[model samples]
Target chain A: MTSGDESRPVTEEELHAHADGLLPDGRRAAVEQYLAAHPEEAARVEGWMRITASLHDTFDEVLDEPVPARLSGLRPPSRLWPRLAAAAALLLAGLAGWWLRGALPGGDAYREAMLPHRAAVAHAVYSPEVRHPVEVGSDQEAHLVAWLSKRLGTTLRVPRLGPLGYDLLGGRLLPGDRGPVAQFMYADPAGKRLTLYVARAESGETGTAFRFSQEGAVGVFYWVDRSMGYALSAELPRAELLRVADAVYAQIEKVPG
Target chain B: MSDRDRIVELIPRLRRYARALSGGRGEADDLVQDTLARAFDKLHLWRPERDLRVWLFSVMHNLHVDQGRARRARPEVPMGGEALLAPASGGPGDVLERQRLIRALEWLPAPQKQVLLLVALEQLSYDEVARALGIPVGTVMSRLSRARATLRALLAGDGRAPTLEVVR
Candidate 1:
């Protein structure tokens, strides 16, 4: 939101276009100056450039795969893609999710508070979504854990709360503070949903005190264990949620994080 | 070459897009199959001056949208997200990052993903992407920006959350 106004030196769209190579050459110098002055914006632009390059690296060779006979001679060809998408050789992926907050003015505490807010936001956004609730389902718990664990660069265990009458629904990777976060969802028999959000604990802060934040009707109990942060969110009585949070904390505590 | 003949040659290109679009080989081929069927059926409606490749993509795009609508109507079986398997290929270089990119692209919303794939993968300019997707150039830029930010978020920290649906 910083430079959204067209009157600014460089607007958000200009940064996107510049990173995307869509910005005209005439405007490139000013953007370079803008990015030079803004380290965060530069990091974001670098991250986008990396994404564009990786996309080329991954699918550019798709044209080389053998075409199935079923698709042959049936319809016209999309033919050759005109260009090979060269020119954006990038080095680092860079830190992300600040762009999620977008040029908003926030201090360290506000940035750290994004953990609970994101957890609650993800819960509210996905909890009511019936058809596409999670990226992976509990039926494929092993794969789900492996995928999410690898992405988050940590060993993760989905808390088993079946005895507590809430079954694990699944989990999804979400954009959040510092890096990607994981949300493991659960649902009771009556279809009431609960979400537990996890992210890597900010370095230099471990075993932080347990904190509760009420985001609208959703109550979130968040705490930072060694190297990992957890937030359990649900729309229930605080005592009831506290019970589940304690259970989740205790269960995950056994895993050595 | 005849338009039909040209389409036959471009089937592989369409298949490539279908794979990125659908994420499942079987489902993607099914989409390409349907696109071919529709292309042949509506061959007469195509204008001679328009770029046939772009026109054919529009055909496939329409089919994808319709299939999405049909999938939404049948809510009995929720989408299981089983379609999101990162295709295992490529040399040792950039294997993980590349896989993450594919998975990230699959995870993006359809509108944003389409704009990005058309512009990045297909080398279509903003105007060309708009023409192919039947959206304005400004709309194309906006979608591309959203898609870029999402990819940046996903790629930066290896977050690849994907979504999918099918009538079956």
Candidate 2:
């Protein structure tokens, strides 16, 4: 071996190799000899050794403590689309009941009857432009698509909404009752914003449905398609909101087969 | 208990590995929990013949990588510098040392860190680590060498010899 090899001192790689139990017998012996001569290095290595021991001590107890009941309990195997359909059915029934009670007029009547206005309340609480606005951005559209597709097991096209004077801002992958959902954002020229949250249904069925409500001045619209759901919300006028909904539907419909 | 239950039992071990890899940040717990939840949700995909702990580790590893990629794609928002440097509380000097070990761990490159953790902390064989990381055994060996050398340098302070006692 060259002098360079001899004086090189046991490298971090070799120490890691030694730590990992990967060094060959001969090299390991050499390293041991080097360490014998080098007290400071020995202490450092010993520190890491202690660190491993400490980690086991600190967290290993979690194993013996009973696993959380919710985690351990048997959960009924759920079909993705069917559960989604059941939820939608319950929601529609609730909406129909409310509509009958009020006897309101037109699609606006149905819109007012069933939308999740609380989501708008949540949106306003979390949506100021700054850090942590959305988990994923439009620049990584490819990754977002792949991830959401894998989770939902369906090809999700990022709907184009240029005609509504809105451009794709970004999207986030969120957990839902069925699986993961993709939430896409669009912004108009004046900086007004809207979000399209999409997820696969637990069942396969198609129908035109609408739910609407007002929360702190924000109008919310939600709908369901065959094996999918969409929610749209903003502070825009009801008519303008419907126009945006139409644009969202048209673009989503054009998602390539 | 079924295979899924057995897999669930391995969560704590997976969490320990994740904590070592992540410098004992609570983020590691989240990583392990997410892995377990995903594995449970997709239990059908797991093959029965494989080791459950190894499979869980693989899931944790992938989730860590995906999260890392997502973090990198976003603009870096600076957290306070002191928060980055403060040692994790709890335990004794040993705990502090462990935190140091993990911080030193962050100094190594990602590939070396992965190889070192799998082999050293998890005590996987070189072959097992290679399979877990989808790298060759030789690459695992070399990477471990580099990782240990770097750790020794960092810990021992500037190219000093390392004191290692062979376990008889």
TM-score for candidate 2, residues paired by index: 0.42
Candidate 1 lDDT by residue in tens digits, B49-106:
8888898889989998988821333223224332233333554356765666666665
lDDT (C-alpha) at residue A254 in model 1: 92
- The segments of candidate 2 whose C-alpha lies over 4 angstroms from its true place after superposition are A1-257, B24-26, B69-93, B158-168
User: With candidate 2 superimposed using the best TM-score fit, by how many Å does residue B93's alpha carbon deviate from the native?
Assistant: 4.9
Clashing pairs for model 1 are A75-B7, A75-B8, A76-B7, A76-B8, A77-B6, A77-B7, A77-B10, A77-B11, A78-B10
Give the alpha carbon lDDT tens digit for every residue of A97-157 in model 2: 6678775634454443333532453345334333344667777878877877777788887
Overall local distance difference test of candidate 2:
0.62
Q: Which lDDT tens digits does candidate 2 get at residues B1-168? A: 877658756765676677666654466666766776677667787787766666777777778787883133321212332244344565544556555555556655667777767776677878778777777888987876666666655544443432222000
TM-score: which candidate is best?
A: 1
For each model, chain A TM-score?
A: 0.58, 0.50
> Weakest 10 consecutive residues, lDDT, candidate 1 chain A?
A85-94
Q: Is the docking of candidate 2 incorrect, acceptable, medium or high quality?
A: incorrect
